[model samples]
Target chain A: MALVEIKNVRKNYGTLEVLKGVSLDVEKGEIVTIIGRSGSGKSTLLRCINALETINSGEILLEGQSVSAKMDGLRQMRQKVGIVFQAFNLFPHMTIEKNVTLAPILTGKTDKQGARKLALSVLERVGLADKLKAYPEQLSGGQQQRVAIARCLAMSPHLMLFDEVTSALDPELVGEVLKVMEEMAAQGMTMVLVTHEMNFARNVATKLVFMHQGRVWEQGDPKTLFANPQTPELKSFIGHHAG
Target chain B: MRQFSFSDLLFLATALEWTFLMAAIALAFGVPVGLALALARTSGSAVLRTVATALIELIQGIPLLGLLMFFYFGIPVLVGKDVPTVVAVGAAYTIYTAVFLGDIWRGGIQAVRQAQWEAGACLGLSWLQQFVHIIAPQAFRIALPATVGFLVQLIKNTSLASVVGLVELARAGQMISAGTFQPLLVYTLVAAIYFTICFPLTTWSRTLEARLNGAR
Candidate 1:
């Protein structure tokens, strides 16, 4: 069974249909990169998989169990999946260590000492060991995003979702956040990312998904799609993003 | 006919004790009521939200003096049961504090970006957990100045309890005036006393605001 599966999921925001009919599968250790125009529903789909947005219809399954909107199922689903947002969204009042350790300690997955140890190691992984005591306001945008990533990594999530993580960073800072993501992918994290960084997508993703008008326009190995012209929408989308 | 005596000033101190005691009771009980009202006003259920909103609005619309009269003079007539003037007056102030403080804290909670709530939800924290852990602390920081400002108002408003014949500061001054026949001197001293109590709180509120902003 695939690690994650979406079968004809549909979502609408009032009169506007954000996802018409979306379906995809993520196998274990697959780095899937979703790319599209701003309104093409990439971020929406990622949110739906994480149960942040309830689907209007159809099914999303993780490890052969359908993702139920019921509290217990959703909690179990979330424990396996971690999501990072465009805004760093770190709790402003908390030190980086507290922000990193809160959910784990509150969820009773670990005690204060164990959560702190996990927080230290994950902060170290993000190259932010020196900033454990620093508040979010004291950090640079890139550093904050990395801490956001480390906060998720501390959960030991089986799957990671990045929603336009670097789009909010300054041009100079974007590289640092992407580098942490690249390292995660390199270490074989099953990552499903909604991103606009074309070169990173082309070079890193094992499978590439192009969304257009709330549908998957095309998808294939990154080498095949980047080198060959398939659909006009994708060709033009790639044209606009070409290096 | 007479001069204000040091003994008379000690009597004023006794009045100040009543003032502090009544205001303390109002504030102590007001905080939890305010918290509940604020939560209800912000809740997802339409009924809870509407009921809380209506209660807060209705209470805020009534004058504190009017409320004091009704709770003190009106209730016994309506209920055909006698009630203590001090208890009724203090209770009115407590309800008044809750309504005003609840409205202020609602704004503070809202000052936090909606994105923070989404971030908390996405993190798998329960809704209550999110408020306790992420939302409430941030809201309290935003709320401290307004809370202290309201507290100063509550302290001053306690002076109104004198209408129901509770000899708080102002009433104490009035007693001294009848004896001393020095109305101007007595009222000025009363105003000065009120200022002493309120001014420090206003300054403390400012300090807290500055410190919290710096931390942010």
Candidate 2:
């Protein structure tokens, strides 16, 4: 069964129509990379899946349960689906350890000592165990992004959504965040990300979706889609990136 | 006119207690309600937002002096009941501080990055929990300087209670000056005492502001 199913979702911001009849499904452990230009509704679609942007019409299901504010067990549903933003949104006032441990204790009733142990383990996964005592401001941008990833991982989520996670980073810092993502995918974790990194999408994604003008223009195996452009839109999109 | 005695000075000094008490009553009644007002103003519900906004504006439009008079004199006369001046004074200060503090703290809440809310929501936290753990703490930090500065203002504003016949520090000054016929000396002494109480608070507020900036 698909881990997430978004059906005919429609979203509008005031008079502006952002997502028009967007739909997709993610099978377990699949790395689905969505690549598109700014304002193409790629980020909006990802946000909808996590219920960040409410759909004006249509529905979304996670693990066969509906996603909505009124949905029963919404908290439990959220515990299984984690998201990371383009900007590292770590709590500046909290230590790295506390940032990682907070959700577990809040959502799962994990005690402080247990949460601390869990924090250390997850921080180690993102190569940040040594920075446990440091505040978000004390870390470099790359390191901060890694801590964000660790914070998500600490929840043991089944699916992770990343919204242009590397776009805000300095050119040099982008690699570290991407490497952490690569490792995450390699561990057989399910990930759906909206990214501008064409090379990473082509090489790392099992399935690549090309979004344009608030719709999925093309989608297929990453290698085949890159080798042969299926439509003039996808052709130019890829061609523009290549040239 | 009576001579200026040390006992009269002691009386004025003791009035500081009433000053502090009035200020405390204002804060105790004000801060929590102000926080509620701020939350309602920022909440997504249109009705709550409008109601809170209207209250803050209505109260803010009226000066604290007017509120003191309305409570102390207007209500008692209209209701045909004898209300203690202290009760009237306390109620006035509470409403005055709540309105002002609510407006100040709302600015602080808005100063918090929207990203923080989104991050908390993504973690599946309930709205109140998100506020308690994530949003409120950050907003309080951002709001600290204004909040403390407002408290100092509150201390000074408590002197306005004298209008309603509560002899706090400022009213004590008036009585002492009238008795001793040393207007300059008594007023100067009162001003010095106020400075002693309020200056440290102003400095503390500045220090917090500097530290907040340094943290960023």
For this target, which candidate reaches the highest DockQ against the unseen true structure? Answer: 2
TM-score of chain B of 1: 0.96
lDDT of 1 by residue, B82-130 (tens): 9987678878988999999999999989898888887777667788989
For model 2, residues A92-201, the per-residue Cα lDDT tens digits are 88889888888889986578879878988889889889998898999989999999999989889999999999988899999988999999999999999999888889
TM-score of each: 0.97, 0.97
Clashing pairs in 1: none
TM-score of 2: 0.97
Best by lDDT: 1
lDDT of 1 at A121: 94
- Give the per-residue lDDT digits (tens) of candidate 2, residues B1-216: 898889988999799889999998998999899999999988899999999999999999998899999999998998899988778888899999999999998998888898998898888888898899988989988889888889988998899988877889999999999988999999999999999999999898888878876764
Rounded to one decimal, what is candidate 1's iRMSD? 1.3
The local lDDT score (0 to 100) that residue A218 gets in candidate 1 is: 93
Interface RMSD of each: 1.3, 1.7
